[model samples]
Target: MLALAGLLGLGGTVAVQAADTPAATFTVRQLTPETALRAVQAALTHCRGLGYQVSAVVVDRAGLPQALLRDRLAGAHTPDVATRKAWTAVSVKMSSAGFAAETQAGKPMSGLRGDPRFMAAGGGLPIEAGGSLLGAIGVSGAPGGDADEACAAKGLQAIADDIEF
Candidate 1:
């Protein structure tokens, strides 16, 4: 009798707990390896066409490099610069150009330059789809930060058609 009572109570408690469980969902969009490769290639092509030896890097949402491409003469350290730019972009979700501008202005967020991973340059841009940030792209080894940014923008443009806003 006592064993039966305990079993019934346990069953009731389990049912009550299940009924009280919350129904929450989490979803996100991410880039494929093929997409990352294409982005890097597009950036490389754009920079090459402009007579610039540049490096491009694509990073995932966590700021991890997915792909990196460097021109034959992009310099030995170009890849590292590109990866850092990508990491900075994804870490803050702000174009490195925009971040540089803000940091230069010295306002509410003046300490942006203190972070080692943060770069106040123009070659980093966040990649987003449907208001969700998917990753980032960065270019380096161009004549200037603005020029590097142009290459990074090309990378993002290459994949814009297939992704949402």
Candidate 2:
């Protein structure tokens, strides 16, 4: 029971009045809008430095958008795509690139693509620290999925230290 409390403490541990009692509630970590905005900015800047116009989106752990940015020259579709990618990352708890690979045509998981909200692109990455998922970031319109993924990685790297707590 003591060991269980330690393991359950991501944001905080659940209260266990007795060994046989169930926890009534649990705490969870969440990303702030400021942090989410910073991630999107870093991703967008990285794409711009590479001469690729793009859009970036950050979604909370619950798959809700916290921040979003679209470059002036980015295609209108980029914003929606970026949001979908971020939402998908948080929803699936994995990088969109990995999801794309797993759900490729003829793959057993390909049917997941049928969901309108699931964008199996490479620009999405889950934001995690200390084994807890805080949010996710996504980038789009960077020439290719690989480039978009790289930009999203930069976004995550930018805030790695801040999210550790």
Candidate 3:
């Protein structure tokens, strides 16, 4: 009987120790500057091939710019728009176009567009790998949002194998 009680007490102590353990940190994967530049370059190239002058921006997981590229003939407003689009994608872990569709006028999330950094555009895409969000890429100044999004997708495809691990 005493041995059983002792074992029970030991088990309780172990449980207490486990419960007291502190969860002090978490791990996150982010893209490197080289990878970001590769993405932007590929995006820009794709847009150029399509006869669209555009700006592309890559943002880290924290929604900070990692790399930006603007074609020679891109509009002056493109860089800013591209940056905001990347910011919006990383901030929400979703494509900016999907957000735009889901948050259009009269939708429950429509108010999200009111945020200065939230761009309801199609050119933004989350950069994901092995189920993790590594970053985002955005392209602007294409003839339309669909064209812009295609350029961004090309950018993501350029780095797909590199980030697959």
Candidate 4:
């Protein structure tokens, strides 16, 4: 019985074990450069349609900028603003406008404002599909945060059909 148990790897330090086999494999969806560019274009067009002259930024799941589009008349700082918004959205996995509201003065999350990379503003929205986060989009140079958020929403709509969740 002892020999059988040992051979079966049921006991002892020199016990045998079952051979390893590859188990589960995962397929994570990523935002391609073309998709990122398409999102940027859609955001820019949406903002322009609203006479916003905004800058749009698309960031990957890691909060890295994948594409950016700035209107000719947009302020020089618009790109930075847009990029920051996209980063905030992907990093936190939520809308920048909501984050802003939650981090306002007197809120428990106010400390988040201390982070330079964290922006408590609107215009940032996370892009999610099939329950997986793809990336984010942001718009800046609009007259207000709401306007910027609207443009960002339009950007996400451009690729809505391509994602599943």
Per-model lDDT: 0.89, 0.91, 0.93, 0.89
lDDT (Cα, tens digit) per residue for candidate 2, span 1-165: 777767777566664498788788988998888998999999999999999999999998888899999999999999999989988898889899889999999999899999999998799999999999888999999988899999999999999889997
Indicate whether candidate 2 or candidate 4 has the larger lDDT: 2
Regarding TM-score, does 2 or 3 come out ahead?
3
lDDT string for model 3 (1-165, tens) is: 687679887884323336778876989998889999999999999999989999999999988899999999999999999999999999988999998998899999999989989999899999999989998999999998889999999999999999998
Q: What is the lDDT for 17 in model 4?
A: 50
Q: Estimate each model's TM-score.
A: 0.83, 0.86, 0.87, 0.83
Query: What clash pairs does model 2 have?
Result: none
Model 3 TM-score relative to the real fold: 0.87
Q: Give the Cα error of residue 54 in candidate 4, in Å.
A: 1.0
What is candidate 2's CA lDDT for residue 35?
91
Model 3: lDDT of residue 159 = 94
Worst 10 residues of 1 by lDDT: 12-21
lDDT, candidate 1, 55-133, per-residue tens: 9999999999999988999999889888888888898788888888887755767687888888788899999988899
Q: Which residue pairs clash within candidate 1?
A: none
Worst 10 residues of 2 by lDDT: 7-16
Q: Give residue 98's error in model 3 in angstroms.
A: 0.6
Candidate 4, residue 147: lDDT: 92
